[model samples]
Target chain A: MDLSRISVVVRMRSARQAIDLGFVMACAWWKPLFLSWLIPSALLYFLLTVLFHHQSWVAIWGVWWFKPLLDRAPIYIAGQALFDVKTSPLQCVKALPQLYKSDCLPWLTWRRLSPSRSYDLPVTVLEKLKGKARQSRLRQLHRENANAAICLTMVCIHLEWLLTLGAVGLALLMIPEEINVASQAWFVPQEGPMLWVQSLLSYFAMAFVAPFYTMAGFALYLSRRIDLEGWDIEIRFRHLAAKQARKPAAGLAAACLICFFAGPSFFDPPVWAAEISAQNKGPKSGSASSRAPEYERVKKQILEILAGDDFHKPVMTQGWRLKKRDAENPNGAALPEWFIRFVEFLEQNNAGPNRIAAWFGRGARVLEFLMWSGLAFLTLYLLLRYREGLEAFARNAAAKKQQGHPPNRLFAPDVRPESLPEDVPTQVRRLWQRGAARPALSLLYRATLSKLMHIGDFVFHEGHTEGECLAIVKQSGEAALCDYTMRLTLLWQALAYGHHAPQSEAVEALLTQWEALFQHGQ
Target chain B: MSRIPLDTQYQVETPEGIDLEAALAGPVVRILAYAIDLILRSIVLTVLMIVLFFAGKTGMGLFLVLSFLLEWFYPVLFEVYAGGQTPGKKAMQIAVVNDDLTPICWSPALVRNLLRAADFFPFFYLGGLICMALGSKFQRLGDLAAGSLVIYREPPKAALSLPNRPPRSPQLSLSLEDQVAVIAFTQRHGQLSRARQQELAEILSDVLPCGSDQAVGHLQGIGIWLLGDRGETTSL
Candidate 1:
């Protein structure tokens, strides 16, 4: 494990940032990560679903319980890809034995429900640690990182459920309202098909969240190690060492000498070192160091290679652009001689340009006539199409002048002030006492609508239903009136449509509230 | 293997020749930030609805218009004015910037925020999440459309606390990397465990040939020397 080859920019990061970095890695290698995770998990789900067909919950639970084992594939892929190792889904599937070879039993058993399973899996899988070593290793890693890792697990868990519900919501959106499937029926499916749909949704949701969960844990592990072991510093040092090892001794000494006298921090370390070495070497002989003979040979060979044909290869590229015209004769004649003679003949003719102009004017006049006629015809056609609606609009406009006095009737019953029996609540109570709950609730509802329209200035159109009347009264900005209207409307709906009778006491209570709300019956 | 580079840092050279680097915010943090915004939006809308409940039809009309503005222009106003951070983004310590690493402008901010509808299509940002996961810079559909990026705000530098030691030049010629490591080692004396410091000190035994017990002190001396701290006491 060469620290220099680790792909990510390693630095001390907050736990959330570490998890985010993990998400980035999972996305970058989504193909292999998804492949390795989805294939086996989906297969297990399918098998369990078939076996436990009657109990779909069992299948989902089985799939979920075995997630720790399935998580290994993504963790393996992410770990390998961090070092730029190419891996396929098939390779990940094949490496399952090696991946699951260490500390697998505990993860499947007691550790299965661990909140930080994603963060802890790499410890058992990648490090291959078991027993006491794994415990201490986890302790060290979790010292400062436990909260974030647990938070990541919690967040991903919520995200999984959210995505599942979102997916179900999207499917529900596709079902047209005309289908007449009740909302309760769509959500609370008691049958096998809906159960299967739910299982599949949840399974895919888990599959979606798995890669991010595993990779985030992996990043947390990597970041923790980087902090404890100084991986970033180690990588830089290794690169420096490799550079030094590659350069020959004499050339390095010369480079150091140049930097020593350069008075800048460009080649930082060597300059200071050269100053010390120069002082130690007594200054005079510092400029003269033994040179390797192979230097000139390598330099000449490098120059010869650079001056080779490969370096000067020609690249042909073709495209179109406007042709550059000659500046001295920018508009020089470039027309055909025949076209020029034709133009001269036309100019010489007496009725040449003016005749053409007159012809254009005639054509323009004809087009103008056609356009005006077209507009006039369209207007006539629109008037004819909507003639009945236009007549109704005019009739309604005339009727609005007479509507200063509110409409006497709204519902099927005439709610005229003169038509009502003087004390409406008393009449309703008398009807309720007679056990005629239907007419009693209906009379109360209609009387309220009539009062709202006439006295309270609430506007109820002729076609407004009981529900619409209630809505109008509620929107009238009077709380007590809205409350009374709501109860009366509900009771009216139950009796009218649903054929459910309201209790006598409930009707009496509504009549009392109605009396308090609308004092003057007439 | 994907051709995209696998790193979180997005670096861009500005017209002024300054290299601006930003840590690209990934899905987890971004999702969390968005979740915070979602909660905040829900709360504000809920409060608005309650307040406007008594105003009847006119109140309902005003509520709709206010919610529309809050829904669409909430992020835009914050990003353009509040240093590119919405309230949620500020809490998460992330900000929006142009692809060129400039402060967010009005048009780009509007474009990115408006395209959130597309990103939010079909479900709970599933399309956006997929795009962000696949994009090299973790850019979602809105970001890609608007040429913007969500990046982690640069954290303030930690106060330097090097140990008080006499400066002594390293006996052997050290490379630039070695100097850095030694300086970091000195700076992180209290953070790194004493035993771990001794272990790291042993890696360069040829350069700092002091006993294991005194290696930390010797390295501190060399770190001070590398930092150009002569015998004088410097405020770090």
Candidate 2:
């Protein structure tokens, strides 16, 4: 293609790339933010349980899910860094002129290259051409650019998905076994097919899964982009003739798979697996005895936490407190029956009055309470942030309009009244022949505004009503005598369709007066 | 981007293509434009008032901008954003280009919105109208001092397909004198280089007969191939 057409293509492509890059980065950036909204809370929940109360290792290990901060950060950074690195290639992809300057081509030779054929057409024929030619060229350029941008964006999005999966896995380990197996998390069901869904989720809270997913997604996006760019073809050709490359390929693939899937298996051994193995080796009676005391204490404590009150203690109280119950009545520790039913209705399978009774369960039931309360906090935070995000977005977008238009004395002087030929008095013709006065006024407003603004004049700021604007002009004395000129514009805009002028005709009359004023100014 | 044909300091060029002088003269046609704008706007507003009476707040609310912003800065925004002319400016073959003869942008749009008062004097565009009528090139106050100019955007047309036929042989029948004349004429066509002009002229001259300037004129007078109607055009 010729230089101008090449330039158009390059520019169109670059802009498309910029937009795509922007979108990819935005999505990648948001992933961690969304993850941050959840995982941190889970970790905090598990950590708080460890700190505030002494829990046995078995009970504690059950809730271990999301990985450590160190693992999460590197994975998160990789997406953004990868996003940055991927987009970096686009920056190198610049204007065609710059492309010629790149290392691939010898600069001076390309810069000074000339078109092979000479194009000489008569001015008369060239003048017959229209602006649509330029516009079409621009549009074509944009389309090609948009395609390239789409490819890059898809790569980034795929990487984002992979990373999210890692986070989900890590979240499984951290799932606070209570939130998972016991349906502690709000609005979740604990049984039937829903139970299987619960297990898949529990996998994320299971600790090391996050880093694994993170690495996997990154690898996947890389592989995908490479494939799309046809880099795999180059790779295969490089390998086809070599000695077996399986060892290197297998090593790289294994390392990626292990980091993504097996990295966390090394941390925090499972206590339940040991118990299960031990139970298989011995009698059931022996296994039950071995689990006796410790299980009972945990069950007691977990029940209390679920009930939201201490059932073991009885305190003497005053009149308003009602009778100082003789025993530490466990029944009294529960909420009112109606309130229980209300809470049960909020849960799956709890459509009736007896639903709250379903809360009675083993040690991990505290997860249910934590999950329910967390739901409230999550919803409120999200709503507030969404509103704030909107306001912030607007404020950020409007930061550039303080400068003014160019000054008048910059253009070449002209002697002719109408820039166009007399035969092309478009507005004059429109006034006489175009539809009604509405179109005419619109034409007039446009023609007048264009004519006035072209004389090195400034348009208005958002402020300054016509009256206020006029006063400022009069006070400035720059064009004080300009009043009493064209009144048509204001009359047309303010009271055009009215039965009477209502002070508007006077405005229209002033426009004609402007013709007179100019004569006076000269 | 930005507008085109940026002005340079201390340099005078004979800009035959889209010159500033030519562009500034456009608004001369807009004086009558504003007069029409007045008539149309009045009629529309009158209808609007009746609509408002029947539809009440509902009608006004639906076309809220028409109720307020339309009169306020809608025209200014549209003009600035739409390349200086409203629908009116467009049909009139006028556009509001920057002082340097580039496209309109935000600041210019805002400035026009602000300085709209100066353009409007004594209730009408009396001030601006007069500026266009009496000032040089019929430019209004804004266009005069702002280095801006009202220009026309070229209409769309098909690309030029120049007539080109490779020469059969280098040894054309035409004489050197006719070749020189054709070369000189074609030299002024900017798209072709001097060498290309010479080459084309040589090819065109192939159809001419051996001759002096007078002889070539006589041959053309008799109707040679290159001598079509262009032969009668002596200004070349």
Candidate 3:
């Protein structure tokens, strides 16, 4: 009767609503239902395929469709068990055959064979409606529930397909190389008889996932009913009303009737009640109004009891205390006689100081030798392991030092490899002809940097300088491109820092050579 | 019979006389989180298998042991020690907490993870999914037995302030609940789109002296007044 704990949003739910509920419910019961039904069905399918010596779609389809029959009993039991606190998965399995015979067999008509009938199962199985009444009930339910039933079936089918694929993939992974080679001929398209093994594998996989589809639909049906009819709220109210009806008969009136028939003496007031009545009737009734004196008396008695000698006695008689231990005492308060004797024996056996130091020095020398050798060995191992990587890092660092300026000083961040137009030589020539010497040289420098990064396979760390770029190009061993790049760099340095703009003829010469170098590099 | 409203927010009263509210994660979000974990597990396994390919028989033995430990204990180890979240749950911004909204302990974490065998029944966690959907707090069977709840880590944002216009008293007196609702609507002005804000305000036009078009400004004025910003009263 804890009304506060009850959920308040109950109503007749649609089929879609039922499916949503069913999906989660299936998640909860997935393990037991899967093991007992789906696994066994799959095992049966495997046995059938092996015994018949044929791999047929008929076997796979039989296993898949046969799941509905196997699942009927479990679904019915699980749906009922949802409301019962004590019904376990084992109990449901134990009661399976009875549930199936009572609920599923009666509904095997040709009309009920459609997949959509899975969602209408609870009404048929739980409510026992049939014929026109069942059809009208289903239609009404469908109108309210909407597309949940169809969606549930579709999702389950898709999940089954995915599971089947996964199973096949796993089997392929585990299959022996010899078997795979032998089966290669059968794997070709349209080889029906030869593909029997593949069909058996698929059937086995389908069996593993088939029960979930049936159970999920059942769960959906239950959820839709809960939503539509407020089953939760009804259960709560019924529980409360039943308890209310049972209360008076179980306790108060029955007890009082038994007491009355027992005896008059038994009905007499108790001694404490009589004493209280006598006190109220006395002139000391005014004293009853103030119980301060009684409280004070009790307080005094408690104080007297606390003040007794027994209360002042110490509980702990023995405890360790710190004390100086001289030769006469031999042992401190905290130290036992055996520990003291052990310390004395160790002192007597101690070696002389000089001998101990000499021994220590010899041990230290050996330890130092071992430590140094280990360090040397570790260094050698690392050098051998990463020789190429270390060499590249050293070359980049050396190039950076030789450049004496950051690479960004020559090229701005905005310059990207693709930023250069197709007619780079024409663009540079136009800038130089207009007496934009520095700007024209900058364009050639940017292009060279982009080309070296993209085609030369050079690693450019951040902060690489112009000298570093030149050093990298020279080390790359492209003699002609290196010679062209060197000439361009000297001209750019003269125009940019020395403020000595190059002549039009010199700029023209460099641009023509740059285009030739670029073409050759491509 | 009336339907029972679903309650996603759980309130826990601490010994310190404080209430902590946890917003429970639903089945959809949990499924997404689980999928993320699955992908991560596969990636780890693939990497290990590739690396160990050169190690011969010993490597194969080690690989099997590592896979077994990872499959069984990875979530348990992370959940107990790594602030109640696995990497996937962390990515999804959800966490496991005790039924009382406290940080989870080892026993509960272990129990929940071990029962995953039960949850994973019938292939791809069908049992766990159904249980989570039906349970009041989106609890799987493992969560129920372990006394744990998976909840959104982030708290709901506070309401926005009303526009800075002069306060004016309402033309009509309102019940406490109605007044609170109006104030809440004004508080959420910034979050809602202009059209949405206007539409919401117009719904309360019956209580205002103004027409539906002017209801937005009228509500803001009332909201400011409710905030104790009483000034010269103006008619709409």
Candidate 4:
């Protein structure tokens, strides 16, 4: 309302201002927005009941969760408000089918039901983007105002939940006799109108909070856009341009007067205006038309004052300096013997400028050399200390440059894809049977690495340890293969490093599992 | 669907005559981070309960104390010493910092964590949610009182380079500000959609000899030239 206080630059707003603006916006077009929510909410509730076979809990929770879908209506209303388009509540309701098509369906998907979705709703509802474009747009919007949007949504959600609880509690308190009867039956309401009452109460509560919630989120989205695009400044500039455009003739006339005057003095109005006014009002008997002579007289008098002798005169001053002052203490106190000796020593050993320069010059050179060498040493030390990190960075960059092609090594330089035998399980079993336990285990480990790298498409770098490899495999979603790999890796490490070989029977069992796993992969 | 400025970069001038920018995290991310911590805490509690199940009354006593200590001091301890991040915050790629963009100290961490009690008032962090929603910087009441910020720990992205091609200068010599804007546009080209990229380039179509589509490429070439990359061979 106060456009003057609204700056050309978008400013960070107080929480109160944000919420108040959202509230006002909601209040302005509450009817259509509310109806838009009511229609969908009821429909969603009906569909949930029919789909879930009138399961009371599912219907209640499903409707509550589906409140986010109804958010589109208010978002639509707020967005329309930005362009000064005031659609009636009925009109907004009438356009619900279109709104559902463009906005609601895209967001109602399960994957999109997230805290981040709250922020994404405005973009989806207002922008109507799909696929990659939608993704890029969402990323762009998220990069700027994800925090504010998220916070607004979270707060509104909590408020909605709280209000729903309060509404239920209030309803229960109002019907004390019914509640007592329900309590007698273990606080479970009779499977009839009571359930509907409870459901309606929650629905009403959500309806009450929906507009404010949606408005706040929309406000945050607008605020973020304003900050990024400098909309406030753009609006101000546009307004100024429009004003100038409307009065172009007057502006041109002013420009012409300024060009005609063509003097630095013509630009300054106060000085000439004051002089003219003074002449007109002050001079009754005197001739005001001849004021130039009076001005000349005043200028001459000022020049005379400036040119006087006192103006150019320089004053003498005094201060203490080693060369200027006497050797005696300035305060008339006797100086200490040590201080006098120091002064005498300086006086006695008065080296020539060349000698002093040579002494400082040599020291300076040595100091400079030390500084440079020290810096060089520090650089070398740092390079040595973080060599592994630097090497990894270089390796990653190189890997990125290569693009689609996988790296040469899978786990280690020794565990190359080419090195693994074709019949991995059979060869590993034969080797294990021949009492070559470590070799067989190592072969299986290498085979698993190759499987993960080639089959699972897991990227492996040089420095990754066995544990890291296991974690990566686990994260890659081959749960069965990951379990096999973990067991094999753990056994291999124990036998190789700890020399704690497993029993032959256990090895035989593990071999069968390994063969089964590789066979499954085939 | 413009990019939201999610993180506020609070820049502090260090004594070394350099600026360090800290990107402040918003409340939603913070909530996710808190949820992670809650899960972790529950896991720890569950494991302890199972492990100490045989110890009966003594185990129950220890568990109660541990739970109390964990509920109160887990975040505080981690924030003070774990580079201003709890394990949850670390996983979420966020950290708590002093308002001046310094690593949070012990007192502020303690104060902020302790005031979680106040934030938890009237069931399910309702008070904190309200405060966080209303507060600028997405700070809850505790953060406001503690003079601290929870910030996103984002790695600095490398500046994007133009494709390798012969250098092309702008038709009109751009001013320094315009040059910066052009460079920024090129740098952000990867993030923007093709349509959006063309739309933006069209704004400078008057100065560009090429059409909107070609203007985007030419602008990128100019940006490359600005960055001192003249491609394989320099073009006049």
Cα deviation in Å at residue A400, candidate 3?
79
After superposing candidate 1 on the true structure, give the runs of residues whose Cα lies further than 4 Å from its correct spot: A86-95, A175-178, A246-259, A262-522, B1-5, B170-179, B193-199, B206-219, B232-236
Every candidate's lDDT: 0.80, 0.40, 0.64, 0.67
TM-score of chain A of 3: 0.39
Sorted by DockQ (best first), the order is 1, 3, 4, 2
CAPRI grade of model 3: incorrect
Please give, for residues B1-236, the per-residue lDDT of candidate 4 as tens digits: 11222224467788898998755565556767788999999999999988787799999999899989999999999999899989989987789999888889989998999998788764467578657655656677789889988877755656574555455543333445456666666665665567766766665564465776687788778776566664543332
Listed models, DockQ each: 0.18, 0.01, 0.05, 0.02
Q: Is candidate 1 or candidate 4 better by TM-score?
A: 1
Tens digit per residue, CA lDDT, model 2, A426-447: 4434553543455444444444
Which docking category, incorrect, acceptable, medium or high, applies to candidate 4?
incorrect
Model 1: chain B TM-score vs. truth? 0.89
lDDT of 4 by residue, A409-430 (tens): 6546366668878778688779
What lDDT score is found at residue B38 in candidate 1? 85
What range of 10 consecutive residues in model 3 chain A has the weakest lDDT sum? A260-269
> Over 4 Å off in model 4, which ranges?
A1-69, A81-201, A204-522, B1-23, B158-161, B168-177, B188-199, B209-214, B230-236
State residue A406's C-alpha deviation in candidate 4, in Å. 86
RMSD of 4: 30.4
Ranking by TM-score: 1, 4, 3, 2
lDDT (tens digit, per residue) of candidate 1 on B1-236? 54454567788987889998878888877877888998999999999999999999999999999999999999999999998999999988999999998899999999999999889877778779878877778888989998999999957977788898877666544666677877877887776777777877665553344776777789889888888765543332
Fnat across every predicted model, in order: 0.35, 0.00, 0.10, 0.00
How many clashing pairs does model 1 include? 0
Model 1 agreement with the true structure over A256-317: per-residue lDDT tens digits: 44444332444345545554655646744543354334435555665686689978998998
